[model samples]
Target chain A: MAASATRADALVHARGLTKRFDKLVAVDAIDFDVQRGEAFGFLGPNGAGKTSTMRMIGCVSSPSGGELRVLGLDPVIDGPRIRARLGVVPQADTLDMELRVDENLLTYARYFDIPRDVARARTQELLEFVQLKDRAKDEVEPLSGGMKRRLTIARALVNEPGLLLLDEPTTGLDPQARHLVWDRLYRLKQQGVTIVLTTHYMDEAEQLCDRLVVMDKAKIVASGSPRSLIDQYSTREVLELRFPIDAAPALDGKLDGIAERVEVLPDRVLLYAHDGEAAASAVHQRGLRPESTLVRRSTLEDVFLRLTGRSLIE
Target chain B: MTGALRVVEHHLMVYRRTWKGGMFVSFASPILFLAAIGIGLGSLIARGPVHTVGGVSYLTFLAPGLLAATAMQTAFVETTYPVMAKIQWLRTYDGMLATPLTVRDVLGGEIGWLVIRLATTAFAFFLVMVLFGTVHSLVALLMIPVVVLNGLAFGAPIFAFTATQRKDKGFPTIGRFIITPLFLLGGVFFPIAQLPPIAQGIAWATPLAHSVVLSRSLAIGGMNPSALIDVAVLAAYATLGIIAASITLPRRLVR
Candidate 1:
């Protein structure tokens, strides 16, 4: 992992940004600053207003209230100017399926008023960059999900944008496909491109994000680095214990002092502790035998559950 | 301006790729209408003495209206479904908006492309009319520009309407309740003067009515001062429609 420099100059700055749909507030007043040459993330589950916020930054959707600046230009008065320097990959793939893969890139390039010859050259380079050179002449419909995503990324890069906004970049891909996309994004970040991404996948957020905000119900509940957030909201380790229905009650208060916190779920109980082995010893010392016991490091998922009181998947 | 031109170019590229399908549909519709209505239905109207305004057959009088009507229909269909697809189904405009092209540029390009498509279809219809002996004098050739203007006038409002649409159910409703009625009453197959006075007044409000009246006048080599008025009305609609689309399209996408 490349070390990211901490700076105060923001490439994207939002002050009390909010969006409303009818009476439903999609994105409440939230403020954040994304600096140059850093990968920022909006880490949230579905319906948390991540996509809405990204759209506002992308200049495709208007913010209902608050101030927003992209590349130091106001999104309302200077939308065209800001959009000229920004690239967006929406949550759903909106590729022009009617055109060939190469034609799609070339057509998008033309929208930026790129000359035909220049567009042609850029299309070739982008095709090779996405590893879709052999499929340049093929229709977009037959390409796999991963290829379509790569093409979308390539299309977003056609104008050589300064900031890239990706909404759920790896939402519905296979494991291998997700890694391929992650690798590609990592390379772009290495080249000093500023990336702002929204993802529900905890691993994706951990792997790509330098700093992130955890949004719930249209508001930012927490914001910090992954490691800092984990340390703030969770212990160093978590021990999971699953017992038979009858034996569960005997172990309820037997290991209270063994951990920092204990959560009793319907099916299982979790012990958040600084040391998992000591917690397990305490549990066994109380003569409570369980069906299964496992000790593992705490993750972002635990932090999300701890803060939101709902599992990310649920 | 260059960005708008690029949008126009992209539309042309798409048209080229799908030209065969487009030609088959656009060309076949008018020929089928000409055959089904003019030839098939004309035989039943009793060999009424050929109405000669400028030494042309009654069929010639009917020709220009059909040409203009066909152009309008082609433009309407082209802008309606495709515009809806770009706004809703395909989301092509959203992708384009990420570039330097403003929403005004997109609207300008789309309307411009509609005019070009209308021209191509009007040319095909004009040739078919000539083959059927319905064209008289060299003045009929001038109907091309007139038909294109007619198309823009009819298509502009439809494009604006489609941009505001969130669903497709109302599309057929508009086509059936509005467009089909205009087609039947706008003097496409017969003279509007032959209708009742109240019906003529209603047809006068329609853009197609102005187009048919002007096209027929040009096709028969008879120039009426009111023809220029009709042209001006169609032009006004085109200009206002383009402006309205430019203003409304951005709100639609950005909101």
Candidate 2:
């Protein structure tokens, strides 16, 4: 009966899902679907309702209105059953500071009623998977931030959940640490685990998410594959020009005909075109002597800015 | 129910990692109090006109009072800073809820662990009383249950209160204002009969005072039917605390 109530093809199905806190609306009416074995994401800046939506899907926070079904079970009614099969990594590291790293996973496995011997075996394998095998006996307090994040990921996998939900999986890590986490998540996806993550990093979304929704101000402005979203909202390449002062807006009129769309930011002027080199040459021909110019391929950042008129990171 | 037991297992693991200092503090504090106040003051009181309290030595009278007080203090302490850490700073409860456990299971498991702590601490204190020649009858073993009830009467309410707190600022206030006052004046050091009538009435209303009365009666082999009323009061307090925790903990954790 629960399966009959939801779309059986998708692991998560939300229709006009909303979350309200008193008078403030954290997540407005929005809709999306997450297919199994795919890496789906909610890409937005801070205060863009990404965490709220993830919490709703994680069954930690109840939605204020509309419909939400996770793993074909209603979150409000079948929360514990749904949660038993779902893994969640919150925005903050909630690891036990007093216990050793391995104990963290072992105790969490008990919450799911996993037997002791099996839990121990899984703990060893998860620590090895997260590259924290050496630190299994070490207390969690002194480990680095990246190590803590990886341990948290390992803890989430102790139950062998089918759907993994990570809220801001790599928000506060160095480039090396971010790549390490992404590598682990990619392996999980390959093993047929459906991954749902929320992040503000456009590069993270591009690298890990097979498909994503662009959320801004409590609503999803766009949703598609990364390449398709970029193609629909942005050009193939972008020409960036910077000036000492805020002169990009003044030169927006002159930079018009060279690119498909011209975006004049406070510090830099962006020209979206198929040939960034040609656009840069056209800017030189217009006698606009800028301090610097660079050409790069269009990224999800370009698509976000084009859709929301704001950068992905504030 | 199994989910709640899992929470108990989690706390046991936490206790296993840091049990040395905690065990020493729990066992040593009651013995230290018995030595300093029970024996030290019992000697001076023996020299006075009223040498015995309730037809026994002062040390005997004070031993059961301290037993009940130890239960109350241990319960209050366990539910305050530790509960606050699990709610806010450490986020252990959030981590638990992310699993198959519900808010009820988490809170139930926490109170269950509190009961275990109360039982162990009470039994240890009761042993010290026996070594001191304080137990006068076979019914003295029943003090363990009375002591545990006294603990839940305090631990449950404090656990509920701690769940609703956003910061730990109010914790010290509860310790200073409510717990300290009850420890000092609620039939611990001296009989509430020595106080004025109004003070006696207030003391009788407190769970510690009832537990102290029941514990003293059991230790001295006095079979008073009024002990049933004392049991009812302690039971009511424990039940009410569980109810309040059920209401507040979910609001804090599942939001």
Candidate 3:
């Protein structure tokens, strides 16, 4: 798939990469390449080996099999050199709780061997960028979860890395906080920094990733832009019917030919069709009554349910 | 090595903000021990027929032993819970690993910071000894190296063991079973000759006991050439601990 030509421009290239923890294979053979300045994503539920793949690219975990290259260098042999040009934000906050907000960035800069004055100037600018400039002198332990996440993001950009890797950048934050993080990440993407992030949130993937791969059970199930994946795997519109508890499955047989496909969850029946309103009218013509109906456009969640036959959250 | 030094610099930077909380213990503990034990208790023991401990006042004799003991305790304290917190709780090493720093750099930097800490506290305690008139000879200045060797001898091995730990339950065990017992019987309070033959043999095997001998001899200005063997032994322990940490740290960090 144009591997030879794109190899030169790919910031991260992986072919048949695998990771094993004892007898358990966390990441099976997976192949993907992230072009320069593009925000790529690995979207999957928990225990799906997204973190394992991200760590391998971050150069913190070794690949048990196959090959991986970051910034045109092997992760195994040139780890420090490759890591020098890469910024990593781990799933959990690794900010030093003992230091002030600004000291965290300053000490991190010293690891990159940035001189003190330059590091100080960049620290101020990063704090401003993350909107944590007011908390520069305060201790890190007292900051809220959102502030800590932003501080971690700011710390990651201290070296002006060519590639930034984030693992579940907003897993536990509230909706408001998640939106703020998404905004900052969007700005970074607009500033031409390559980003690689993993998330189980379909909305997060749709909001920030230029391209994404759907990973499930240690393998990549699909790869495309969000719109293209939905178009290829799901219909243009979906009709939602909320029936009594556990009754949605019994009615799947009665609604057969009106839609391209039908999915029966425990509490709702989803109909995939070109025109959701027509599907609803057909259901009404069949003398079905006593339920609520809603028609909406398809999203990545529908694409994921179509591809995996399971809900993203469950 | 420069990467390791950067790690050391990071610790130093953190210490700058928090050193005052610990300054009382690091610099003042030695003096308090000198006043309470050396001058206070020694006065009662001086009235006995045996007034001198190997040809010097009891204060002078106990000063260097406490110096070495303080270094040993400081090394152990720095290595155990703090190292565990960095690996498991605080995850500071994980942060460093994401940068240009390697596992070897983290280990080296930690040991280097321990050396700086041990050296400064040992020197400050030495000055306290001088202020109390316990130091009798200029050769006692050699105690600094002995203190540093004694520190690494404990710090490196403890650092290695801490790297392998997932929890801090083992640290209190190290303190109770290992550190406290050594502090009591490692010739810090009195000469090992006062103990029975078997206990003396056990005391001589510990790095703390050997450093006590080296430091006491240096402080008394009666440097025993035979104590050079203690130097070699402490150096061997320090070197082996450093090597062991080099192995275990990478194993724990670079997964």
| Predicted candidate 1 versus true structure: per-residue lDDT over A90-126, tens digit per residue | 8888899889999999899888777889999999998
Please give the lDDT score at residue A112 for candidate 2.
Answer: 92
Cα shift from native, residue A86, model 3 (Å)? 0.8
Q: What is the DockQ of each candidate?
A: 0.71, 0.85, 0.85
Q: Where does model 2 exceed 4 Å of error?
A: A1-6, A246-252
lDDT of 2 by residue, B127-152 (tens): 88888889998999999999899999
Clashing residue pairs found in predicted model 3: none
Candidate 1 whole-model C-alpha lDDT, 0 to 1: 0.85
Q: Give the per-residue lDDT of model 2 (tens digit) for A44-140.
A: 9999999999989989899999999999999999999999999999999899998899999999999999999999999999999999999999999
Off by over 4 Å in 3: A1-5, A246-252, A289-291
Runs of candidate 1 with Cα error greater than 4 angstroms are: A1-8, A243-255, A265-267, A287-291, B39-55
DockQ, Cα level, model 1:
0.71
- Which prediction has more favorable DockQ, 1 or 2? 2
Candidate 3 per-residue lDDT, tens place, B124-158, comes to 89899889997878998999999899999999999
RMSD of 2: 2.3
